[model samples]
Target: MKLATLTLAATLVTGAAFAAEIAPSDVQFDEYGAVDQSLTGTPGNPEEGEKIMTNRGLGNCVACHEVSALDYAAFQGNVGPSLDGVADRWNEAELRGILVNAKKTYDGTVMPSYYRVDGFVRPGNAYTGKAADDSFGPLLTAQQVEDVVAFLGTLEYEE
Candidate 1:
């Protein structure tokens, strides 16, 4: 009986410590996880961001969501969450997590990683064994990711 009680106490204490390690707000995650950094500075231009959204060789954001206002093409995908009011829902760091690698934020996600390393399988061919490009290739450059983040910042809802 004493051993069982001690084990329970240890479990409870460990759980509490783990909980304390998390940030107070739901918006903050560690450098390796989702976080909030929207209030830091000016974001990217929506117009230039629009280009990334529609670009098939770069961001290809339309392949997973319907940013109707941004995507004029009819073949936009519907696999991921719609990006209509994402800016209102998430801050820059949060968006960065989803953009950089949605699976890091939510496991079992079909979204591919844009900036993360070692999370994907090795590719075969000319790009052979390169971490940057999966079977599809690198989604966007770091600058392009920043531009997309800036563009997403403009998607706030009118209150």
Candidate 2:
């Protein structure tokens, strides 16, 4: 029994450390809200991004926007503009900013920050302490942000 308790305690500590390492603690940007300095060598994958876009627990982007690449989604939100030609409108860095936090580009946008971890006035209990759910932890990892950006980068108004 004591050994089991010790093992569990060790596991919890290790888990917390891992989470702390992955959660982004700060938001960064360059002029035009385009450069996502956070994105490093972790290459984005459009295929994986499509899955995240429709995932309610992940990006859940379909909950608030329409994307041409995500036609199979049963319900695409209309609150935001269509992403048919998003790439044409914005470049890679711009899309990164939008995906990371649209507020950087559009001040009053309802889009939540996928990779921002600070300045939340009053977060919920579920997001109060845990590294995976904290006011100083981003909603999505850096890789996830890059993946989504890569997918959006492919969209363009085919005229």
Candidate 3:
């Protein structure tokens, strides 16, 4: 029992240390609310972005927005607009800004800022019900935001 407890403690400590190492996002929005610069200086993988968007524990974007490409997800939400031909409507920079922080683009939007860290009213650690500490980072990592942007870019109108 002692060994198990020690192992769990060690794992938690390691995880916390890793989480603390995540640097805050440096993305800057343009006057048009577009993030023309890449947050991580790395191009995102659309495949990984798709996984993040669909996963309930992760992005769970379907909870608020409907994506016809993600038809496999039941009960895609309607709170947000249907993401059909989103790429045709917005460019990559604009998509990046929206994924990083939608309110910057559209005021009064209910969309959560995936890459912002400082402005939340009562931020908490993931599912812990504990007030977030310095170790608490943005809702999504910089790369994760890029990935989602890449994924959204793929949602072209399937005509």
Candidate 4:
């Protein structure tokens, strides 16, 4: 009787442990019933996308990456991963997450938060608080971000 009880208890504990290890599926629907999936189905124009990619006022992707064999633009840093085949490695949502707020997923990251709307302290003028505001504040607008995401979709590896 003691042996049977111990075996049953052990089995129950093992099963519970296995159940605890299970994780939720990646894709999830929001409160508005919109299916949150990566930017897989969107079509993009490489030329227009290239403009955004290089534009310092917009995507500014070239600031940290060497994309395309274009003209001589200076100050391209190789600090981050080379975006040669970013589309092959990450889906749209993942890219969006990186663009939106890298710090949420990775703490102590040098990457600036782009899409964060709340909890941001407003800056004072030169007399009161002379320090410059977050100069790296979002280079691209929301629509521009969507456009960039569309463009990044095209950078797939030839597999």
Candidate that would win on TM-score: 3
The 10-residue segment of model 4 with minimum total lDDT is: 20-29
- For model 1, residues 1-159, the per-residue Cα lDDT tens digits are 999999999878755544432211222356556644432233446677778888887778898898756656678889988888989888778887787667767878888766554435555555444553344434665556667888888887656
TM-score of each: 0.64, 0.74, 0.77, 0.56
**Which candidate achieves the best lDDT against the true structure?**
3
lDDT of 2 by residue, 1-159 (tens): 999999999878755544432345444577666664536445589888888888999999888889866788988999988888888999888888888777878888889888776556557765544553533557777888888888888888887
Tens digits of per-residue lDDT for model 4, 6-124: 99998787555444311112323343322344322234445676778787876677788865543465677687666777888777666666665565556667766555443444564
CA lDDT, every model vs. true structure: 0.66, 0.76, 0.81, 0.57
Score residue 57 of candidate 4 by CA lDDT: 73
The better-scoring model by TM-score among 3 and 4 is 3
Any idea what lDDT model 4 has?
Answer: 0.57
Query: Cα RMSD to native, each candidate?
Result: 13.4, 11.1, 11.8, 14.8
Pairwise TM-score winner, candidates 1 and 4: 1
